[model samples]
Target: MKAGVFYGTNFRIGQSSGGLPIIDNDDIPIALVQGNRDGVANPANAQETYAGIQDPPKAFITIPGANHYGITNEDNLIREPNRPTLEQDVAIETIARWSALFLRGTALKDKGAFDYVFNSGDALDPNVSVESVTKPIPEYTSVVSLLGLGVIGASSLLTNMQKLVKKST
Candidate 1:
């Protein structure tokens, strides 16, 4: 029995390369655990990946109210102390339960573990006041031009540095 866990924010490799690697048919009984509220690796990407897999025993568990960093017990422990601690025990228990049901050929439903996060209700309290929601057209255009110029400047600098190193060598 083999099992694989993939979080919604675990799209670093996926986004860097445009999309995630396709799952081979040989790799069966895979489990993908995603977060519904994830900003980085959106649920759509996970769904796409799940759809690409040709395996039969695949399960996609979308945890509601979880953000990019909220799914991990370590992240929750440090960032949110006031909330109930999402200890390692809970994570291990969830993983074990999922694995036993999915990979062990047990007669469990396709719906994987859907544990409610403790600090889901806590809203972010920013110290600074927010300005206008919309930016001026001219300002936005200027910002884009400045960013383009910065990129060009950085590229020129890198080219010059490489030339200098080559000359020295």
Candidate 2:
């Protein structure tokens, strides 16, 4: 599971200082689901990112008591007791439901799904726990993982290059 981040609001594809690309289709909505319990992707990060977008398809969703990867299932989550508790299943359901609404504009069939997703709780609640919910993923693993990634990245690049060569030929 990879967490992708594009820091700073100014996303420029061209030479000019363009703010952001206009969304042509509403179906391909841009959204961000931030975990209030996560310090890494904090409320500030969400606010800044939301501010950067030129036009928003939907309001950013803030899941109460979720960590950085709150969108994923409970098995993938690490627990921190001091924080506002979130059920693992609820976290998964919330993300799944929220994503469905944004990317497909399709609402979750479950009765309370839409209402649950729309409940954007307090982003800057000072009372929430600041203790680390999860440890550093790479740090816990062997350095060999880094080498494995390099190999994978290189192979991926090569595969793409081969595809481009075939297309040109």
Candidate 3:
């Protein structure tokens, strides 16, 4: 499960002779974090890039009331003035938490994290607006996997039974 994280990314910057490089890559799972109030990097560019992805799990998270420099410690208004309702600390914390969850879901294959990121939990968060595309869980491709799960379950049951027997004795 190869995965990637991008924060405040400008998809429009590419040095290719053809101008902007293709944003679509179906092989790697990716999480892109953006600020809805960003004045520097246009949110439209991120939206376009996210739309181009055809397959593989992907998440686009827009931090509400955050600006382009929200990922940073402070926004230097001289570089890019922004109107951000979210404080820097709050924005940073939100980005960190979501990014970690995204990595755990995709890279570590953690079901709880995956569920929150790609399923219903993120929708309830007031700080973010999430758009996600999920690859279906691959079918069990081999009998070994089924057998392995069965064995683990049996072992757990046996251990619990032994503990109960000891307590009764």
The CA lDDT at 41 in model 2 is 46
What TM-score against the true fold does each predicted structure earn?
0.42, 0.42, 0.73
Question: Candidate 3 — which pairs collide?
Answer: none
Tell me the tens digit of each residue's lDDT in model 1 across 25-114: 474456566545556666677677776666545566554444455445544444433332234445434444443544443233323321
Segments of candidate 2 deviating more than 4 angstroms:
1-28, 75-84, 106-169
**What are the per-model numbers of colliding residue pairs?**
0, 0, 0
Which residue pairs collide, candidate 2? none
lDDT of 1: 0.49
Worst 10 residues of 2 by lDDT: 127-136
Best by TM-score: 3
Cα distance off (Å), candidate 1, residue 65: 1.0
Model 3 lDDT, residue 6, Cα: 87
- TM-score for predicted model 1 compared with the true structure: 0.42
- Most lDDT-accurate candidate: 3
The 0-to-1 C-alpha lDDT of every candidate, in the order given, reads 0.49, 0.47, 0.82
Task: State the lDDT at 71 in candidate 3.
Answer: 86
Name the runs in model 3 displaced over 4 angstroms: 14-21, 24-26, 137-169
Question: What's the distance in Å from true for residue 154, model 1?
Answer: 76
